[model samples]
Target: MEVSKNAYYLVNDVLRAAKLYKLPSLAQLCRERLFSASPSSLFGGGVEALAGLEEIAEQDEKFSDKNSEDDPHKQVEIPGGSARTLNDDMKFALSDEVWADTVLIAEGHRIPVHRCMLVARSEYFRAVLAFRRSSTHLTTEAQVSNAMAVVNVEDSYAGIVRVLRFIYYDQVVLPSLNRKDAKGDSDGVEQEAERAEGAVNDYLAEEASDQLLEDLVAADKYRLERMKRLCEHAICVTVANCLEVLAVAELVHAAHLKQVAMRFVQTHLAQITAREEEFRRFQKDFPPLLEELYASLRDASREEFLLRIVH
Candidate 1:
């Protein structure tokens, strides 16, 4: 006979939708759904405590300047004033005692509140908890298998955490790229370039050649722009040193690293054009790869793909 505010709002929404859609059955279904539902309440004690702490911290920061100026010589005197210590000074200066108390209370009560809230509204936080559980499980499995000792991949827990957070919440957390220390005058450009090249060389040294190539392929597939660029630069440098390796890698990486390989081919087109005989010979050696490329082009949309035979 009596409906709560939430139920009344739901019923009103259903009626409004029904009038627009001209579906009376939809409204009836909504009412049946509401009447059959049981409501559960959650205590927001931990959240409230945290909110209060934050409010205290904000207030402290706001009034800190005025308080400091008003009492320059006023030191917080501890009981049995042997000497007011650094901890006492900081505690008094920051005025964080109240905030700390709030945090401690929140920490004590958080687990139970979170558990209750999670049970009540599991749908909202299900994906988050699932991701956290998956990450913890993966780490445990990796440890059991001695993955860290065996796998020689770059172990960036921070990077993985950031990527996971992004996937879970659609948020990016990229590091700043501005290298002011590395930049300088025109003559410094060569030194900077050499330093950059050396850094890449060092990174490659840490990783296996085949593994680096796989990472590049994965980066391209995932559309990781910075990583893709790094891989392209690495491949280009490798190709520059050993043209023969490029010719071989072109075939091996044709499928997964098509975009990068295509760009590499285009970059070295001038050299190939100059050595017409060698160009033909190289093409003959990888006839299968060329055919595959042509097939890919054919399958691609007409507007997107071009069939130009560049000599």
Candidate 2:
């Protein structure tokens, strides 16, 4: 079905829902319309419209180093405690309840937050915290007081915290793998160290991978594009999380992440397919994704076969 004129502005929203509901034709139509739209219109115009300009700037020498010396961005200097100090101060404020004007409740955790910070950082939160004026001419103190104080979020506490941390400091901090001492005698010290290292690696490979998956989903849900990119890069480096990452990338429409995950899957197809449980899980939980992977594999094989025939 085609997108109606009344719903033209909601094509992106319809696309996401169509994908979720497995409506390929609707999704494809929405994608065609969305892709046809100019980047400025797609991204709400202004600075956001210039999102990919840096890539063009890098390739065009006229826009590059020759003019860097006179660039206003390069001329500015941090006079005081450095940008890190400012970030740290903001992070500290995330936990400081005294100055907080709002609260975000997630997974039974009550997180104090500032309305100004929320308004500045997220469009979702801005709408949530926006005051409703009863009349066009006037808004009373009581109407202003109707602004959100406690917002209940459906995301996990960790996910909410991670998103808030990114909002506060513009950083994605993954959970660190801690080194635990393996039980052993002094004579077995070398072996113990190796065991400890291996154990830590295994635990992090599983646990950290899961955490990154959750964080990426949260980042996408909150429209934190930069955080999602950071998560995508971090997720790409892991073999253990590739499948789940692929699933998430597709679900969230993270094109870069999906491409990277597809490459990872292609390279590790043998190893991944060997795991019957995981293969079965993919078939059950993500049938469409599994079908696409097989189709991709077949297409790759056909191209390779044709190239060999020519050679």
Candidate 3:
């Protein structure tokens, strides 16, 4: 289970692959090795390693100091300056109606947005606007341009808003889940008192999972590749959402995400199959995906058996 010092750089890449491949033991070992290994080991020993660590620490301190500043309107001072202020400004602009030239309607909810921002942030929006202008009559160009443009989008209000927020801030802002308080007392009454609270916590988790799925779908439709990958990472971390994410991945043709979810299912197949109700629903909705999962499981079993026999 021990990773060699020479293989430190490979540990992180191997960890990610191991997790995706459903090798929990290997992933855990890598995780422990990564956290336990010193910077000196990672960079190699001697004064050079010490100098590099100091340099990294100094850079991190400067970055932190810059972020801790209270100025929200600090202009970009250099090429690719820190974007905390810019992200804040863009988020403010997203809510400001005075300068917005376009309104995006999602699920009957009108969202005011700057055309320039959308065009700058999303290629899909840029192409859509370009097509509109090209197809419009020249006589009505001035009149149409002067008037506010309204575009109807066929996505849930929350989903569209999540995508818009990502476009504006370049961050995925997931809803915060409140942690349930742990009771010290082991009495039945104390445990009974927290049963309702536990239920509420479960509900919040489910809500967050649904929002993640929605964000994934929206990210895919809008062709936001980074956001899509982020959403997939978020979804893949939660085993409870694996089935749903797998279905969505199939629908969206997200090959990597589908593979990750398939592996998760394979790793936890016994527990997943134990939940007859949920498993049945997933099978009913995604029969092809279920078949693929079983095929992968069979292939994996065959490989494992052959390896054992060879050993």
Tell me how many clashing residue pairs each candidate has: 0, 0, 0
lDDT of 1 by residue, 1-311 (tens): 13453564456466445534444455457657645543322113477645644554465455555545665743443378454444444335233233221111221221111222232333323444444445654556545333221111132444333322322233343333333345556878978877986786655543434444544444444445455445445543334323333544563444334565544555555664577666566578877766754565455535354444331
Better of 1 and 2 by TM-score: 2
Give a tens-digit lDDT track for model 2, residues 96-118.
Answer: 98877788999888999988888
**Residue 146 lDDT in candidate 2:** 41
Model 2: worst 10 consecutive residues (lDDT sum): 75-84
lDDT of each: 0.44, 0.74, 0.77
Q: Estimate the Cα RMSD of every predicted model relative to the unseen true structure.
A: 19.3, 19.2, 16.2
**Per-residue lDDT of candidate 3, residues 193-308 (tens digit):** 68867887878888888888888888888888889888877763355677888899898877888888888888998888887888899989888888899999999999999999
Candidates in order, TM-scores: namely: 0.25, 0.65, 0.67
Clashing pairs in 2: none
Best of the candidates, lDDT? 3
What is the alpha-carbon lDDT of model 2 when measured against the actual structure?
0.74
Q: TM-score of predicted model 1?
A: 0.25
- Alpha carbon lDDT at 33, candidate 2: 83
On lDDT, the stronger of 2 and 3 is: 3
Q: Where does model 1 exceed 4 Å of error?
A: 1-159, 171-176, 181-257, 271-311
